[model samples]
Target: MNIVLIGYRGTGKSTVGKVLASRLGRTLVSTDAEIVRRAGQTIPEIVAKLGWDYFRDLESTVCQELAMRDGLIIDTGGGAILRSQNVDSLKKTGTLFWLTASIQSIASRIGGDTQRPSLTGTKSFLEEIQEVLTERTPKYQAAADHVVSTDGQSITQIVDTIQSCL
Candidate 1:
């Protein structure tokens, strides 16, 4: 089975995914990175040129494709769960771990990242985080096989918790 990491951008999904994949000797596949690779553009660029719908379509395709593989550490984009089909596809042969952190923790972790475009174009950074997290929390909770909190935890600690859960 694959181990899938699902969470907000700043929740350390990418970082923990790397360590988990290394520790378990599994290939690490990030859906976001895959989308960028397949589209030949960064996320912000893709979103800017094609729109969020197009970006999400690419994300869903990546999720579906990765779901067919095994023994992988699949790190998904934050909005991957917005579509039920994506969640269903990912859960087919994967155990989903939802990583969560407080808004402050998330902001501090991703304050200066420009690779991803603003999810909400109008809100302040903190407000966008709060709004997006609030909206996605239920979807994350519903799709998750296990929930891991990243607040006050190192990447190692987070990976340890995930391993213990596994």
Candidate 2:
């Protein structure tokens, strides 16, 4: 089965996914990167030109494609689970781990990152994080086979926790 990591951005999904892939000798496929590749643009560019709906459609396609494979480490975009179809596709042959962190942790981790466009155009960065996390928590909770909190944990510790779960 595939090991899927889903979480808000800055929650360590990408970092943990790389280590998991290396440790397990599995291919690491990032849905966000795949979307960028398929669209021939960065995420912000895609969102700017088309909109979030278009980007999400691309994400769904990627999810469907990835789900057809096996033994992969999938690092999904933060919003991937917002659509039930994407969640369903991912869970077809994958065990999802929801990585979580406190808002403060997330803010610190991603404070300078510019690749991701603002999820809420009007809100401050912290406010956006809070609002988005509040909205997505339930979806993440429902879709997750396991929940891993990243606050105060090293990458090794987080990976060990997930490994133990598996």
Candidate 3:
């Protein structure tokens, strides 16, 4: 089985995934990075050029593919849980770990990142984080087998917590 990390942006999924994969001797696969590589564009570019719907379609495909693999530390895109099918697909072969952080912590972590496009273009960074997190919190909770807070936690601590869960 795989250890799948799913959560909002800036929640340390990718970073924690690396440590988890190393500790468990598993392969690391980041859906966002894979999407960028396959699309030949950055996330913002994909959203701008192909539109959010297209990007989401690609994410769905990635989610399906990731679900069929084994012994992987999968770092899912932040919005993967927005689509129920993606969550179900991933849950089939992986233990879902939802890495959570406060809106303030998420803003501090990724507020200035230029590569990611906002889901709600009308809102400010903090507003977007708060709104999106509020809307998606239930879905995340539903999809997770374990939830680990990344707020004020080191990479090792987060990894240790996840390992203990497994």
Candidate 4:
């Protein structure tokens, strides 16, 4: 019952992950939270000091560890699909579900978070998010064994959709 959630940020990976985990009686693990815990810093702090490459390496390590766990729901970082190896590893380990959402949904949930390193200083923030999301389209699709759109839906509905997928 290793249900891994992969998607762009603010797509409700963490929130939906918690719901999914509860519905399925599974443990929940968030890679970003794990990275923060291990590094004793917030994601923004880690990115600022250690850099993206370094953070990605850690993300991979965390993914590897989570891959070996059982009865778990993993909420991966948005860019976790950037590395093919990470995608392969996660797919091999569990059923990967991509929580698809519009750029508007993403911006609505995360627009105010200054700690969001990805779109913090971008000139056209929504466009920037859209661009990044477009860039990852094929990769996310390739990595996911299933897909669920979260826009205009309640969390419980999203969880129900995930249950159907499983």
TM-score of each: 0.99, 0.99, 0.98, 0.94
> How high is the CA lDDT of each candidate model?
0.95, 0.96, 0.93, 0.88
lDDT tens per residue, model 2, 16-99 = 999999999999999999999889999999999999999999999999999999999999999999999999999999999999
Model 3 ranges off by over 4 Å: none
Question: Which stretches of candidate 4 lie above 4 Å from their native place?
Answer: 119-122
Worst 10 residues of 2 by lDDT: 33-42
Query: lDDT of candidate 1?
Result: 0.95
Measured with C-alpha atoms, the lDDT of residue 42 in candidate 3 is 98
User: What residue runs in model 2 are displaced by over 4 Å at the alpha carbon?
Assistant: none
lDDT of 4: 0.88
What is the full ranking by lDDT, best candidate first?
2, 1, 3, 4
The model with the greatest lDDT is 2
- TM-score-superior candidate, 1 or 3: 1
